[model samples]
Target: MKQTIEQLADVELTENMLKIAKRELREDKCSREQSLEQMRNWVLKHEDLRNVRLDDQFLLRFLRCKKFSVPMAQQTLLKYLNVRRTFPHMSTQLDFLDQKLNDIISSGYIFASPNRDKHGRRVVVINAKGFNPKIYNSSDQARAHFLTYECLMEDQATQICGLVHVGDFSGVTTTHVTNWNPTEFARVFKWSEQSLPLRHKEIHLVNVPATLKWLIDFVKGRVSSKIRNRLTLYTQDKELAKHVDPACLPQELGGQMPLKAIVELWKAELLAKRETILNLDKIALLSDRGILRKSNYSSEKSSNGMNFVSQIESIEGSFRKLEFD
Candidate 1:
């Protein structure tokens, strides 16, 4: 077993983790030599990507997402980098440090648990109880989400071990539900389905209000079956503990630490990395627009292998039923 960040904030990768990270270089079809060769070739061919640091860990994210298929990994990496270009508002910059954005984040809207689950997946809790639809719109919420996820991705353990989400709906009201933007929600669904590099193992929604049950159906239509199957809804907080470790949860959900303090730590870390994040966005913006070199790769290349396609189709075929549903 490898050690990751604990409750108090210091994170150090153990020798076992280092070994696992190194082993990935040779384990899949995107073997270190093959993948790096292709990535370096792709970068060399495009002037824009030349300056982009093709760090092994960074490249591995795309490779693992694509099951280590060289061509598939290449195409996904390029497309993933172009996310900022497609959605300018989702830029990874100092914008997240804005007062309003900070306010939303400070409210404990979303934060990751320092602890990992049995599978070693990091726990990401979305404190919907802290959400006030009146004060923050979809864009504000989206930025807050982007910041938290982006920062979380920086941790090697999170990228490899994956994530499980806990949506605490304890304080949700009609106002918040009404304010939920279906369009933005759909966009997020599509992004998670097609582009997000991490493996979202599961989603546990706790404290579901009777009135909010319909929201599940609304989401089912928009998200792929894969995600829908991972959805688990609970009417109360205790039911959530059956699925997630109590110690891994925030005090808001009967855990040790207060949610506010957890969010504060995450906010401080984000502020510290402001410059590095902004520079990454600047590079991506340049590459996305072909300012560096036009991505000659075609999107259709992603479909050649049935393994990846079937992985998605399998999700489409299955649907998990919630107790309320």
Candidate 2:
């Protein structure tokens, strides 16, 4: 019943990992009912985790991300919710049905690839050429990006297999930079570096125009060192294709299908799940709580929730070491 190294490396939900999760994180092997109950009970015992959503599927992502180390996963989950609490403006309200937002999202600027990598990780492509700064500002476009990532996280397969991101900046210009908010951009990157439970298998930025060099440089310093190092910049499609399979890229970059059609498909898929996506803010953010009470460690004290990760790391070795690693 145990999975081999090949299965684990493939990112499958192996039997052995599930059993370990069941024991350490109180995950259920059969149904979510048991896990949900256990999470609720555990949350009730801790004041900080009270407002945090105890959804079985959501918690499982954190557990798997941390290799089912309960304490570390709990902290990651806390930081995840804390992001929503800290930045209510970005996290509290997301309207998928908004025509302008939908336009940006459905523009094929950002979408999941139809193909997977050798590790079964889903590829998320971002075509900067599709971006029209004249139509949407950086913040507005960021919301769409957030929603796209959020929707992808809903699928357990995507979480396990992880994600590879490709950003094509073939046609971006300095004029577009006129509309960017450096502060807001930092917050978005910080949120992903600290809160999001999804694994980042790879990051590729292709077709970088010279005008955007300073923009990229600015972003490099703003982001965490881990993210900065994980990023790979490419000036040509040939170099980009060397790292990412062209078969997994959009036609704009020598891939299978047209970017326009891919955008339309993404739009249709998002519209169908409009309600569910909107409701995520209700639980993810603290603004919905009516009165803003201070969490044990508020955003003012934590700053991008890095404190949670630090605290989690300090206690990580104390917990039973996971078998997989």
Model 2 stretches astray by more than 4 angstroms: 1-38, 46-53, 284-325
Query: How close is every model to the real structure, measured as TM-score?
Result: 0.76, 0.73
Over 1-325, each residue of candidate 2 has an lDDT whose tens digit, in order, gives 2222244436545555445445544545433444345556776676444445555556667766665555666666677777767765665556778776777777777888766766667788987767798878776777777778777776566656678989887666654555555445455666667678887878998877665565577557656687788899987877877788777877778777777777777777677767867777656433333223345322333345455435433433322221210
What C-alpha lDDT do the candidate models reach, one value each? 0.65, 0.65
lDDT of each residue in 232-285, candidate 1, tens digit only: 998877788878877788877877777777777777878876765666665542
Error of 2 at 311 (Å): 27
Best by TM-score: 1
Residue 74 displacement (Å), model 1: 2.2
Task: Please give the distance, in angstroms, between residue 218's alpha carbon in candidate 2 and its true position after superposition.
Answer: 4.1
RMSD of each: 8.1, 11.0
Clashing pairs in 2: none
